[model samples]
Target: LNHPKLSLCPSLIMTIAFAVRWRDPELVGPARKTPRETKRLSDIEDQAGLRWHVPFVLFYRGRGGDAGADAGDPAAAVRRALGEALVPYYPLAGRLREVEGRKLVVDCTGEGVFVEADADVRLAEVEAAGLTPPFPCMDQLLFDVEGSGGVLNCPLLLVQVTRLRCGGFVFALRLNHTMCDAVGIVQFMSAVGELARGLPAPTVAPAWSRETLDARSPPRPSFPHHEYDPVPPTPFPPPGDMVMRTFTFSPADVAAIKKGLPVQRGGKKATTFEALAALIWRARTAALEIPAGEDARLVVAAGVRGVRDLGLPAGYYGNACACTCRRCPPPGPCGASR
Candidate 1:
């Protein structure tokens, strides 16, 4: 990542003053209750985790000096809240281990790491510059990505809190995508925020029954599931150049797109997400300039959080998402509406 061309990105302008590793204080200690044996991942949980890392960031506005006594000290509060939050979300404190089957399971070690840093830039300047993607702001603030071995050897959940010059801060996280999904991480953060706000405990305690998402014992199937089928290993091609970009859609714009979608006769109306996804799929296909006889695929992530029959509890904070691929002919107006 130190390539000269990459450094030309605007976010590199923000400098780091000091970065220190903060571990859980002895007083808070590790969670007393943890799984005894290695928690195996389901087959549906693809091995792509071996290479993927999920990066997320949270922005908090600072309370000026006159705000309150506790308001002046933010880092201490975050440490305290994190220590308390680790009690229920203990798996995050663990390290990845390889078992006999060559599969990885968490060691439940109770030793997550946090990095606290001081940034030279102010929060206002960052917001003004636009925190768009290729999310350089987050990359600049997080200190864990360097030197730490990839997902396999890195901490299960690593956090970086950058104190902006204007007193506000940016909380950045890099989690092993193999351990949890975006929903699960957000739930974990919500619990930490609740504790920071003086709540005695999280509203929903975490459940770690990876077996809950397993396929039926006999592997009975009512329909074909080609998406979840395993494929033989293939030679990996060398890396290619790719450009990362992000597009923003306001609530009003999203609503307008949904309204424009043709509704089914006497059926349910399309959701805002479905409408926007279809629009993007069509637009992207049109831009690809592929042959009409060829096929185009779109992989969409579907969360099983609230599906009644899955029997997943409110706090089942693990990988509970499935990636479904839709194949269509690269012809006129992609009408795939998933």
Candidate 2:
């Protein structure tokens, strides 16, 4: 990951200072009683590398009127919606336990963390500072409760809804990576939103047939799995000097980039993602001054939900993606081209 220096003016920097008063943490269970069952996670899901929490945040502008008046108590609404959503996605409310051979299983304990908070800033102020990646005071915004950060025998999902003084709220959550990937989490959150909006049930029912993705007995290796191979360590700048930035490209910018690329023999133009990824990879390689003799690689995660053979149901929210690596050798013509 490249960390370019952030150049912000003095006025913009002042917006970073804000205090969030967090309420006592509470455990929310399914609105209705869910079955008490233990289910083993797929081999891919419980891999040693996937035992961690992934944090995400979303900002919403305040509705007209005083805080909590027009919104009608967002914290309570979120809590209620999450409880109802947990009825089908109960595994998320369960705690992860390690059984024999270090395998992971959901204990179906029916408990998830929820925190209500209030920030002393307006939504407009936050947006003016730039509503992008590397958000300011992320720790306070998320608020990792004590004893809630463990990988095993801990809450699988932790949510904190911070209401801004202007009535807008920040929705943040930390989800266990072992349980699901980005797609899975998004599906679950969407369901919660639907229920909050008075939907009878989730548009797509949640499914938990993880055994379908389990490895076959006496695993057969069909192709090379180089992604899991150990990678040589590379030097990095000090953490203090590293800064993450988000870049936005308009549709015109994307069209311009695609126009510069060589046309395909079949007349199929490169996609926006393909063009941008290629452009960034080449620019990053050049900016880092990597040696011409060294190999540069880009790893992209491709979704496998569309694969009919996998038999992943409509709402199978497990890790159903594969990482493909593309290696570029030296700064050749392909890398130099627009």
Candidate with top TM-score is 2
Residue-by-residue lDDT tens digits, candidate 2, 211-328 = 8888889899798676676766655668897788889999999999998999886999999999999899888777666777666777788898899998899888999878787776
Clashes of each: 0, 0
The RMSD (Cα, Å) of candidate 2 is 5.4
Residue 172 of model 2 has an lDDT of 93
TM-score of each: 0.79, 0.91
Best by lDDT: 2
Please report, as a residue range, the 10-residue window in candidate 2 with the lowest summed lDDT: 1-10
**What TM-score quantifies how close candidate 1 is to the native fold?**
0.79
Q: Count steric clashes of candidate 1.
A: 0
Q: Which stretches of candidate 2 lie over 4 Å from their true place?
A: 1-12, 68-70, 333-338
